[model samples]
Target: MFTAGHLAANPLPPGIVGALGLGGYQLLADIAGVGAGRLGSQAFLLVAADPDPALPDAGTQISLHQTRLRDESEAAAYVQLAAQLGYLRLSGYRLAPDRHGLRSRINLVNPATGAIAATIPDRAGGRLLRGGPGASQLLVTAGALPPAG
Candidate 1:
């Protein structure tokens, strides 16, 4: 359940039906925690979903046909790989959530030079802009916090 503030912080592309799903969310979390992919919300990462003959009774994987995927880990991996393979042009987010809520790393891309940079937008405020000198993005992932002393 996304809150109003979260929604405001991270606006979705107009007419994009459905949410980023739990699997997608988990993938983003893993990315932030493990540094698997770059993260950003500044630009949309183009993704397309396809069927994997591995899920059991995975309940209609129709949304995948166009990357309008449901919350599934397999789908997330597939998309992530696609992004990396250049099958999809990803200039944003090596580690960003499907939606915004807590802080998450955002991959900021310099469109003009095709360069990429990472930014922790204070709290995943949706903008992937480089935080002025020394500023950083903070992400809250499941069990990512250190044990309190």
Candidate 2:
């Protein structure tokens, strides 16, 4: 998980950010990435997985690229570009102001199919539930993620 403090402490190189299609955004917690270790391949994959307490050994795993953006409009453009570049699994949250108040939401986009997997309002004490193709349902919460066992 890469938090804002972590980023501030050890900033990522501009090249990495650009390569990941994560420019103009701030990274938050609950982040994970995978590289072709020892496979002699340059492909990298970033993803997040949440286990469902109701079903042991079953949960959803989606490509995770958590970011804090200004609004959905800005995020749409980034997501589109990332998808076009073959970023099949990209997900993040957006925080924007509204007349009622501040609005926050999470979006999971399957860039490969050009479809939105899920969208949930970002709020404290809430859970974002999702299931990948042929995978069990997963539970994601707005609160701090449970310590990995």
Candidate 3:
């Protein structure tokens, strides 16, 4: 289970509750390796819960619902996403995990401008960022790594 940090428990909004009742949205996570070169490991953080189906579709809709989601679980998801973004900003990899392997092309975009701030490219192309303590916000999925040499 993913950590919620300091988020407190609260009642969820009607829209989210209804959507959950209807069934939709899924909580997922991608874990990255901590080593360098070919000596690294990776994992995933996936939740059985899903997002509210009635919840908005576009970024604008999600923005609107952000203010409405008071439930601890819903708010936690936002925090987790934000943490993941922060992790990417620092010295970590941003992974999009699948059934067999992790994805390399992951772009952390500004939800507001849709402008690409930090771009993580495929194993053959991009380089990972580096930072100090507190740099790692939340553990992220493993960006596609080059094959073992």
Which pairs clash in model 3?
Answer: 25-50, 25-51, 30-141, 31-141
Q: Give all TM-scores, in the order shown.
A: 0.18, 0.24, 0.23
**How would you encode candidate 2's per-residue C-alpha lDDT over 1-149 as one tens digit per residue?**
32323223444446545654544433322222211111111111222222246645311111322233234443333333223222222233221111112222335444344344554332222123632211111122322222222
Task: Give the range of the ten consecutive residues with the poorest summed lDDT in model 3.
Answer: 34-43
Model 1 lDDT tens row, 1-149: 22223222343333342433222321231111121221222222232212246743211111111123323543454345323422112322233222233222344343454444333232212224742321111222211322222
Q: Residue 85's C-alpha lDDT in candidate 2?
A: 20
On a 0 to 1 TM-score scale, where does candidate 2 land against the true structure?
0.24
What value does the lDDT take at residue 21 in candidate 3? 44
Worst 10 residues of 1 by lDDT: 57-66
Question: If both were scored by TM-score, which would come out higher, candidate 1 or candidate 2?
Answer: 2
The lDDT of each candidate is 0.27, 0.28, 0.28
Q: Assess the local accuracy of residue 114 in candidate 2 as a C-alpha lDDT between 0 and 100.
A: 38
